[model samples]
Target: MKKVIISLFALVAGTGFAVAEDAGCEAFKWPVTREQALFAAAPATPSGGTLAVGAAADLALVPVDKAAFAVPPEHAPGEGTFGAVASVAVPPEGAIQISLSGEAWIDVIQDGKAVKSAGYSGVKTCPGIRKSVRFKLAAGPATIQFSGAKKAELKVAVLTPE
Candidate 1:
């Protein structure tokens, strides 16, 4: 009985590990096209918390805790840029408004290509002025890449029309 129990435990644990491995960030391919990123229809709204990319709502607020993740390659404030990835599911039609509350630039990537980009302009602040970029989005899985001046925290909001 003791041996049988141990074997069962190992099987369960191994299965859990496999599931986790498959869910890792590597599973997502970057720079997908706008069309490729669309969902068949609008998905349900997401609740407040750490922004869940593929499960985010029409309005997703993402917090950039600099201490939480490593900074990506640098770029001029409004020029080229790099940062972390947030998965988002856009509607079949309409536009997504990407806004930043600090010194940061955002790139919307579908199928590993940047479809749209919003850069920062004006004076930088702790909770900086709201800079935004709006573009048409198709329903699907899209990646939002954020890069900006080194700061303790930043807020990013993705808003879609009602």
Candidate 2:
């Protein structure tokens, strides 16, 4: 009985010491200087739309008829799904940024399949600033889409590997 108890104690102690640990990744070192830090910041990509010169135009102009604007009844509000468009191409190493005028649920699709999805609730008034999401795509091109009941306008931008 004494030997069995001692063996159990030793096994428990050994198992505790073998737990997983988080190692600081040296490859992801922080910025050394303020200038370098600023440079290291992620760069924003241009929207795939026309450039505006003055105060921004109203975003909610009906691009299509009301029936056309209606989302498919089956599509739920959440991440990883879009009511319009089929696929998005994401670079293998960078991320994608989307600008919206209202709240939305965004979905990410890759290689003709749904990879993941996320919901982004409203922050402020309509035509809010852009929200960026980073996704590592060692696999291939990715497609992202946004769908929600809110009448938000949206534009998409893609960032590629340097």
Which candidate has the highest lDDT of all?
Answer: 1
How well is each residue in 3-82 modelled by candidate 1, as lDDT tens digits?
Answer: 99999999999998787566433222221122123322324332222344232223222344321222332343323322
TM-score: which candidate is best?
1
- Candidate 1: clashing residue pairs, number: 17
Cα RMSD (angstroms) for every candidate in the order listed: 17.0, 12.2
TM value for model 1: 0.45
* lDDT tens readout by residue for model 2, 1-162: 999999999999877654422211111222112222222332332222221211122232222223132233234654332233323444444344333333444555555455442322222321233333344444445444445525534433333312
What candidate 2 gets wrong by more than 4 Å, as runs, is 1-75, 78-82, 117-122, 125-127, 160-162
